[model samples]
Target: MKQMEDVITIEEKNHIDELTGLHNLTGILEHLRGHDKYSASEDTVIIYINVMNFKVFNQKYGFAGGNDFLRGMAHELKNIFPDELVARTGGDQFIVLGKSIDKEELLDKLDDFREAVHNYEKGLKMKIKAGIYRAKGTEEDPVIMVDRAKMACDDIIRVYDRDNNLYTEELDKRNELRQYVIDNFESAFKQRYFQVYYQKEIRAVTRKVCGYEALARWLDPTYGIISPAVFIEVLESVHLIHRLDIYMIDQVCSDLRDDIDSGYAVEPISVNLSRLDFELCDIMSEIDKCRAKYDIPKKLLHIEVTESAIASGADFLGKHIKKFRDAGYEVWMDDFGAGYSSFNNLKDYDFDVIKIDMGFLREFETNQKSRIILASIVNMAKELGIHTLAEGVETEEQYEFLLNIGCEKMQGYLFGKPKPVSEFVRSVDCSFENNEEFDFSSYYDDIGTVNFLNSTPLETKSMEIMIKLPIAIAELHGDQVSFVYANEAYIDFLKTIGAENLDRANEIGRSKERDNASGFANILKMAESSYNQRSEADLVANGYVINTKVRFLSRHGEKAAFALVSRNVTAQKEAHSADDYSAVLMHLLNLYNRIDLFNEEGTFENLFLCGNQKALSDIERKAVVAVQMYSDTHIMEADKERFKKFFDITTVHDRIESSGKHYLVDYYRSALPGDEDRILMYIILPFHYNGKWRFIAGCRYMDELDKLKSVLKQIEST
Candidate 1:
């Protein structure tokens, strides 16, 4: 019997880890199988613990120190949770099983253990994160509990300064969402939820499209639209980013193949390559496969890489970039000046183009320092024998500045926002002609003969003043083909559509249906030769689709002055809404004697509306100061008191506190002398903007205020 007991002890010892003397994975499973899990009256808690930065710890202290630390940690955990199962599940990770401990007690114990790890013997310090799952005694599979704990731990790891987390419904929902993505990613691709949009890059000097950058967008069936900012990171975590990246490359190649087949002029379109793409396989081989499969020229497809990606794998990137150049592909280093080692990257690697980040141009108008820095970067890039592109150039001033500083290319909203490939192709196919005849015989006959060029110098100056008003206006010579004068609005409008001056506008705005300059000239000449007729004509420019009505006036000496009233019809075809929401808000405000719209942060959208100009100015000043300081405590005391009464309501709080809905607060304010006897106001709207909360509130003094109050009451009752 003694010999048999010795054999049993030896077998049990074999199940324990040699280094930490804790149960190995198999032993842990065996121990769990022996538990009367379903009979436990109290909840059983499974904990997953991970040592943070363990790899770095091992690098600094070596494997011997690492092994010693793990063994000590296992012993400490066993002592802390006496009579519980403690096991080394994997590298730098441990699991604990216990019963009867609630969440608060478990968190306290974990916090204490974390602090203990920081103060271990010999000053050997570490930090750990933990996830807890409380079982309801009905679960049969221990693996399910382990996975839940691990998911909780991963959630904690993703956030900073967070140590331990308990599994909750929200985490369960997020896991479901991730699983859906993992399972349906291929289905989504097949169903065409994934799409490519192109943003055009134009030559700064010529203001003509030179290339395009391909951008990916995802339209999820249930979520409507999922931002790449959210989904891409999830995909990267699962090592599936390469799949999406390759799909995007294939789309680019297929588009180019069709464009070439149609015999259209081709532009180099660049696709972004993530660092993971190179890690998975040879990037060049993938590119070669796509190019060969599509039968497109290598030069038509460019490659773009971010600064961080190159910096992380400089040696590999350098070799690959050289291969790209040798194979007739241009390599662009994107988002330059966004990091500290930008210059170092440029020095170490070979790149055909450098794209300056858009951030520098954001403050170019106000910050002299930004201007100086941008100028320095442009000059340095010019000296380095590399082409430079200024990205995010949204304003005319930025475009002109980049042009003057010798930036080879420019891209941003100033040109146009990115659009779907189908829409972009239509825009590219927009063709125009400049040779249509115009006849004004009927109107010219009515004009008979008017004085032509018989105005005094003062009169001419007055006409100039009229033209220079905010409205778009232009003056043409007798021929109406040559521009005599263009007002500021006209010049600005033309520039907005990529035309430099009236001459360029005439050149680019020509269409097959009409000759813009010639048509106007004919109208003026016909008016001059007519009998009491008023001659007129209409001109249209495609692409920008500008429409202008021209009226010809002739003076006594055959000189003609034409007035052109222009409207940009592009907005009618564009996606943004032109309806004035502010007008509706203003009308709502005027119904009350005095009103104000404020965000939750106490910043006012509209000041006092009671015609108290002084009060409005004072409140506006205070509101601006409060927002600048990022504090609600600095707002006027009376305003705070009024707002507090509204926020204090439970229903109102429930609606606006991270609820993504609006609530209303109705209150009364006593009037002063000469004011209305009764004043009722409302702060009934809650909203969020730019990651902050806001509200809309105001009071009105009207006999009909009670009617509006009745309407609001009806809404609430329903």
Candidate 2:
């Protein structure tokens, strides 16, 4: 049987790079335009892979090693889709394209890429994570897809490197800058220090007022209009952008209230909150204060956010976003048409409105490419029963073009510039009181009825908002390597026993044992090696060792990627540190963890009081001698005689930063340790976990029933 090579006449052909056998970026773009896919379908996938660690790799290894690793990975990728592509756009990365498939398959293939690439590793290890998405039907352009991929890849790579302690050094440098912005968010914009600007969204047809989008404008003290992209990126690195969101919400709320009080027709201000904020569920109650103080309607204060907060894959995103949506605040999806994964976000969320990034709207008139995408986006929104909004409508051509394409509404410079809250209020025609409700309310059909009584708001501050940092994967190279994705154990260690390695790669250090157990370094190396050979590894470096069971990730038997399980070592690390505590408590804990103490006599024959309580007289030691009688929640006394140096008697819980663990310290002098000169009595804190008592010893005494005999014996001994 003969197979046909389907060929269409290509006026111009793209030359793929010879070494990697991947298409040059120019070739990829040409190919995109040559194929009708970008002009036709709502489902083409475009992903760009950028080698973030390429510089580090080249510096560590020779240039040849870098190329060899990339080429090998490229070869492995080539085999994944025999008919598709593994085009090298140049440098250490490449581009991949495939049209229309199951979304699950797309994601699985990405996972496989992460796994199989390790198989093709060259002499030096090299790995790259990519951002992926379904192309915007016919409106898709190569550059947009590539940028989206870069952004996605950057996000994943950041999280990935975080696990291995790679980005810790950079983060240290960012802390000062982050703090500066955080402390200045409100005041920074004051005195013309920073300015708040609002961009408006109008009704699709009448071009009337919808609401304004609030953006941060840094009126540079030293410079002017400091690039938002650059500074904003820096703040994100330090995780302080949340403060910016807080500042925006607070200022806008106040500004709106003032305008309304002045007899101005100002509805609630629409401010964009970050996914980080929405997920914290901390803004509701705070907003409520502003709502009541300003006499503003909760519904008027619209929170514009990305779709992720509504239903991102992250463990915490959905529940938190619901806090706002459930409370009766408007939640919108901004930059609706920019990213490839927008549809998934749409499917996952209950969005009141969608704002199409102006980029696409600008191109809609002349670019057939934009027309295809705009239609796809508009049509999709129509089907989902969500409203359509095209942002960045700078030209009449674009506005007219959007309408022709079935886009119901648009916003861009052609209409007007983003004004101040007062100016915007003057611009809008509708009054907040008279308006029944906006069309965006239709998304609530799934939300059912909102109960005002049952719903209470969250605690939010103007600058400080509480958030649970989800555990992310971190990686590091060089000697001071460790996990920057600090979990409880890691943070506990930092708080209890501070590590003063200023040059420390990350907060979570790789334990000495991880050298044998194979920590994040080995995990990444295993993944890198996958790009060349089908190899596996299980080595440890840090104390928190992991059995990174790995296999060469390959497509059709060729090494293309690598995948390994990220075993959580939090519990193991804590358990391993048991011996690091006070000798007495460690001894007691040692006796406690292994054997059942239910039947054994709790009192010790030779009671030797040691530590700070040695100076305390006999009677003072009695409080230190506690009996552990209960199974959970220990009762301990404030013993000051012996353990006074570390914790005052009044302090029941003293925080120890060494292991980042909190300690419930019970300090006192106990004569049982012979004359109260030798030892002090200290009972450890105990909490129930997994149907058993987990202990933090030498800190506080547990006055449970189990220790009653020991308490009596100690009293007699004293």
Candidate 3:
């Protein structure tokens, strides 16, 4: 009898867990396999318990404390079900097998376990999640049953506020799908089953393609099409997301190379990076390698990091983002308002663009709060000097709302859905006309600053003055005048005309009689002519004798955009014809040798020259050229540096800010042949409008102004 007892003790030692004095995984499997009550009975139940955030507890206490906690948990489980088979499977997880009981009774037992855990330390605040699986039939392998229970437990583990879950067939299906993705991910990646799709990012004001975002699509042979939502999470869990991210970068670079080699105009393409990408590899080095391999420009490839990613690991992500930006890649913050710490993230890191969360647009029509929040976000981003892009803009109403709120960029199905590169390239008009060089940065700046619905006034008094004026932004393509935006007064003017609404007015603008000698179309035609001349024009339309002033805004290919301001002048028109005075004033202005206009940022607004000087005529409409042209060409060698210093575009803003001055004046000696002894006056007058300042500068012989002053003095004496 003593010898037999020793044999039993030795056998039991192999089955027992050293730390908890409970059955280990191997012991549990062997016991279940031998016990017919569990292996063959359909009434048996398996419960898997996983301690959530045990690492926190383990770190708070030492490993020995973690062992003590586990042993205590095991003792509690045994006390709760003395007749059941209880085991400490592995690493803060335990398994219990027993005869099936009522689910409510089992839930009561779980509640008791939770209460006991909560009371165990009070300071620890650790929680345990359980997965319960009832046997459907005899299992060939007990390990499969254990895994199924663990899967169900995992479902609850990820979800806060949930302590217990029941195993279902769907869990099995999900497990199988996860396994499939893991098993075939490498094979599919090498076989070229993964393709990159491009979704266009549009300039909100111009409705032109500015860039694209690269999205991954899996064209699996067996699964046909696996949603990124399904596979991305699985890959992230398995730490394989870095491979997919690098693959996407390589694919995007390859496509861009193809486009460049084909002589197609390519825009910047942004590739998304997972947090795992940074942890698992040197993602920046990998991206640089791919870019160099394809010989792609750094500006053409952008990096997108999610707001949550930054919020999760801010210090780590901030370093990576700085590296990317230092390498000349623009890093954009994706899903701006999706998380609670959005403003915190913005404050903590630098991002070139913030993609407003799609949820705002999705609920735009139904929720009024969304509009308020979205508008606030756009305004805040603008004030911070960060660009804003609205995502999921899928309707005309949404697009119009975003535009009205001054969102700079947008992307969604309303513009174009994500599609394979082959299809996307076909849809876009890649053939760009080699038109005269234009300042696109200035154009985008103007677009971003304008919000007709809520325009920023130069002063409190100017708000009322601006409200009375009718303003609009019109895009002219041949004879068609598409109103991209119109103020309330402009829309009201459309009502005064035969057109009842803006849509009707645009239809009339697009009519066959657009070239008529009168009406809105005639005004558009006048604006078109003015755009060609690169000057503002006085336009007359039929209704109410309205006076319109149009100035060139921007141009792309054959399309030109104009900003128009109109007012009803019927009373003034009946009293006098202002056209005569305007013509006389235009001729008077032509007396100047050179005139140029630029915004506060030193972006050239307009350039006018009255003389046939080859050097002056050849000057480009750029800040540097406009500021230095006269000094370089016509000023005396001794005065050239002085003239440049006095007319420096860089110091203009600071001078204005410090002096509260509206104009700057400088006089220099001329270097031109036959005008060597002539003194020229360069005058710059700063004009404020629509919450911005523009400098209108003119250069003329000082003698002309002296002669006019003498004439005025003579007239006064008479």
**Candidate number achieving the greatest TM-score relative to the actual structure:** 3
Worst 10 residues of 2 by lDDT: 450-459
- lDDT by residue for model 2 (585-669), tens: 4476433212111101222111333332222222222222332221111212343333433322223323433433334433343
Model 2 backbone overlap count: 107
Q: Clashes in model 3: which pairs?
A: none
lDDT tens digits, residue span 1-718, model 1: 2322322343377567788877666665554555443223236677999987687678777888788778878867876776566778878999887777777777877876776666443454565889888876566766777788888887876454678888998888888877777777888888989888888777653465667899888888897776675567678788888888888888999988886676555667888888788888777788889989999887788899988678766688888888888888889999898753799988998887888989898888889888767766765664465677889988998887776444667889998787777785443432112101112211221121111111211112211111332122233444435443444555777665556787765554242112244545565566556674334444343333455545554443433454444555553444434335345546765665444456544445545555531234344534545333321432233454555555442345465545533356555443343443544455565433333444545555444667888999999999
Q: Per-prediction count of colliding residue pairs?
A: 24, 107, 0
lDDT at 713 for candidate 1? 100
What are the models' TM-scores?
0.45, 0.38, 0.59
Model 3 scores a TM of 0.59
Q: Which candidate number would show the highest lDDT if scored against the true structure?
A: 3
- Ten contiguous residues minimizing lDDT sum, candidate 1: 432-441
Q: Where in model 1 is the C-alpha error above 4 Å?
A: 1-17, 21-87, 94-142, 152-171, 189-193, 202-209, 218-243, 261-265, 293-295, 306-318, 333-348, 352-417, 428-718
List, residue by residue over 353-437, the lDDT tens digit for candidate 3. Answer: 9999898887788899898888778767766768889999999999887876668888999988998866744434454431111
Whole-structure CA lDDT of model 1: 0.63
